[model samples]
Target: MSPSFCVCRVRVSTGHCTRCARCASSASRCTRLPDPELERGVRAAHVLRRLGSDFVVFAEPHLKASNMKNLLQKDEKKEEPEQTVPCDHKTASRCLLNLMPVVSETVSGTLLNGTFLPDICLEVVHDRELSKLPFAKSNLTVVLFADISGDAIFCIWKADDKSTLADTIQTVVDCSLNIQKNYGEWPTCIGVTLRVKIGIATGMLEYHFFNDDFDNVHYSASGTVVEYVRNAEMLCTAGDIILTTEAWNFLEQKGVHTRYTYTALPEDMVKVLCFDPSVTEEEKVSFTSAFAGVRPALYALNFEDAPLLKRFISPVVVNIKTQEELIFLSEMRHVTIVFICMPEFIDIDLATLSQLYRIISAALKETDGVLNKVITFDKGCSFLAVFGLPGYKGKNETCNALMCCNKLVHEISAMNM
Candidate 1:
């Protein structure tokens, strides 16, 4: 990577910062925001973010690094003077996925060359792993599906956890393929060589409500130029551990060595990195053991949807672990939960309920805020929304809640149904 001259990273106005390639300014001056006392009431400018060589906004609209004052005032006339209690029952869970055989029967009805992993089951397993990861880590989940029965077990490190941990799951897989010559008939009973194909990838984990039911959600990973792990598993023979470029890069960053470039794709298509087990048993033993007590798991990906209800909200009331912990967290941060409900949902037929769901979804969108966790009960339809999330800090939580609730109500009322 050669250096270029564009280095003007200072803001001259709201939501806009300028970067000049031929800049000769001091480093400290370039990164600081314009003092609000000196530069106020400026026009809103386009947000600029650099991606690779060029700066652009790709998908989700991210606000510029600045505080936003609540413009929605309580003095405004309200059709409904009272507010309903927000849905604060449930929370998110952060855990590393065991990635065990959660769906053997569903994916392996017919064995194909000792490999029968279906895509749906693959995603379901990914979702299960994602539910355990905590917030604060990059919410990126990478799945490396082992060719042996489509099982996966990776490790993760919380952003706050500093202790070193081993990915025992990877070691177990490495050990299973080594017991062939241990004088045990386990391999003979299995009737086949236990080879594991490991593929690693980094991608976006996206979700949408399943059949308009927030309780049931579908999650999928989309990696950019790093989805080779899925394809690499098909070409590699069993007992082979193949790592994608993405995974190898991560390992390189972590200073974990147990890998060598085994070979290249037919025409240099993609580089194949592997922890060659064919090396002497001593080396293989050192290889797997070399990774123990490493900070952050090599295969761990954190699935962070902060506030738990950032996308699909679950119904299980999250029992706060301890009252003191809850009180401490509340004191440190503040968020207003909003629950949207349709009072007549219970009496309606399925057909009518479907129509009502569409109406409510549209109303939520008009609020310009995310619908965190949504709950549909027998009595009515409800959504749980938090005003101020962990990383995202707005000026006023109450104003945000009021504005969101008002916008949703106004949209629903205008629907004429």
Candidate 2:
């Protein structure tokens, strides 16, 4: 007769088996040889041990993968060539371009594909005050700021010499039109309508780098020019592209031919540009063809090298061990938003900043809060955290958020001493 196998949770180590209390009575009679079903059950038990009951839902997949090898073979067979679907090359390019900020390497391919924005770095002085920086250079730049349904912010800027003013104007016009037309049709946005608001500004920008970490250094820019674009972006309605007077004048001066029609916003101060419903295909081709050969440089931030950046955006990334957390949190629920700002944090020494980050990270972890976003300015830094995600239905999220904030204040204050 085949040896009886125990279906209870088992922990195997050093050629010995430790059984849970529930199965201890049958431990002496259980078989210990390899069995696919037994192995799958063991894996699920281990997953539950490591990730807690919250991940019990994900364990089902591990249990079902008892025949993973055969499943992989079936998947390989499905990869055989089949009839292809026609796709829009331009729309594909735009989609890839939109992801440039998140996936750094794609920036090169995106630039090579079309007349996109040029490469430019906004420098921030690290571990030092900008007022004391001895050397700085000012460049006339056109900055473009895009807000995607309040989910993410994309900022791109180019110096005047990188490309002609006509090319810049044409590029933004093309961008605005593409977003308005194809954004909702994309696979990720198919069921939802995402609003894309754009703001453009042209002004003098001052930038410089710091010597904090030579191996992984980043630069930042200063000047009211950034604020101008940010304000213009905030004033924008869905599908609206607001341009500052300076930016508008640059296009007017360059005599750029665009199919967009401009109208002064009903307010006394802002200028708005909208797609022209009556634009002829001939006119679109006429303006778009002028920059047919344009290839602007694309310099994107390397997120892999930035540990702080990774930590701040950790909630959005899924981990194999705790992927269920993300899956469970991906729904709408009431959450307490916590915004923390460190004014003049740019001048803080790297050592102190590292300590502060650790303190805040520990506090948030203790309180079960999630960091949603982070932004670094020339003189300051701010981060957004949320509590009471969908998965934690029983926990008092507001209490957790308040506790986290209280701990941050105490810890940060002690650190400053």
Candidate 3:
């Protein structure tokens, strides 16, 4: 017969092999056997240890291999399923981690932006006050707006004489503090250390706010304005008021002149030497009137037959323009009424106008006979509706009118997309 290969069984607790073709009398002698038999013996021992005292050991090699494979498959079946994390949550986590170090730096920059408004106000106030002094108008207006050791500082000086500038700046600073104390509006917070830097700019009142052509025009300080202020501030020491070359030139022309102590600027800084000073007050009044007329017209459309409109319409005149738009509404009594002298026609496409009308009609239908036909003149003109007399608002006429108008505008705008 060919050499028969037989598996041996070993008891892990007793460290003894049961009778088989590979068994040895002594446990230590088991290692002396042939390599093939020794491997089979070791594998058997492992299996016996895992199965405990009552496990059956087989002499067949094929059965042992199949059993080990089944054991591993069973172990894998007991594990929980893996979960997926959302992309947005993961992205937010990454962003917060990256921004952690820079958060303080960003906050410091934002604080600087808020300080710009207050600083400008201080400089203007100081300049006006100093100009009143004898012979001070001819020298440069060096204004410093800063905080020193938690005290708000406003300093004004003239650069022509260092001793005079120091004396004037000290005097002005004292007066500014007294003004704040009297008004209960100190510039600095208590218990916090603060420092101020000043910028000196001199010129005629070349820049001013104006209302022309129904639009308000003020100094158009784009991104460049903030940058210039920041550069000037950076060059200044705690009490020093620094000025750019452009500002010095304008100050010289305005009768307040300064000798440059430090004169250098980055190549990118553009000099804003002059600006126009003009405004039209008439256009502002007209614009206000136009807005007032349109506000009520829009409000009336929102609340039809509302008690408020009765009180509201008496004081309001819909026709704000020289030429009025007209609206025709069909009444329940079979009489057609016209709303004359409406506001100017609104410019809208036919499709949008049709949709707006549909929304208004649907909203009115909800209130029964309180509202009926609505007629609007021109594409975007105010609407005319007969409320309560023939339809929806008859019983609740006081409130229904306003309610209908409000709902109509809201629903119409919602469907615009």
Say which candidate scores most in TM-score: 2
| Model with the higher TM-score, candidate 2 or 3 | 2
Candidate 1: segments with Cα more than 4 A from true spot: 1-138, 149-194, 203-218, 249-261, 267-417
The CA root-mean-square deviation of candidate 3, after full C-alpha superposition on the true structure, stands at 39.6
Better of 1 and 2 by lDDT: 2
Model 2 lDDT per residue over 331-380, tens place: 12244667676775644444444444556657767786654433345236
Q: RMSD of candidate 1 to the true fold?
A: 23.8
Candidate numbers, best TM-score first, in rank order: 2, 1, 3
The true-versus-predicted C-alpha distance at residue 206 of model 1, in Å, is 4.0
In order of lDDT, best first, we have: 2, 1, 3
Residue-level lDDT tens digits of model 3 in 1-417: 011111122221101111111111111212123333333333222222221111122111111110011111222322332221111222222212311132221112221111112222223332333222111112333343332222222222334553344333333333222222232221322332233344333221111111112121111111222234345545655444455555444444543232222334573222222121331211111111221131222212222222222211111112122222111110012212112112332333334434444454455445432111121322223333333221121434434545655565455446634
Q: Give the TM-score of each candidate.
A: 0.27, 0.44, 0.18
lDDT of 3 at 114: 17
> Can you tell me which runs of candidate 3 are displaced by over 4 Å?
1-193, 200-221, 258-417
Clash pairs, candidate 2, are: 119-297, 122-220, 123-219, 123-220, 124-219, 124-220
CA RMSD of all predictions: 23.8, 19.8, 39.6
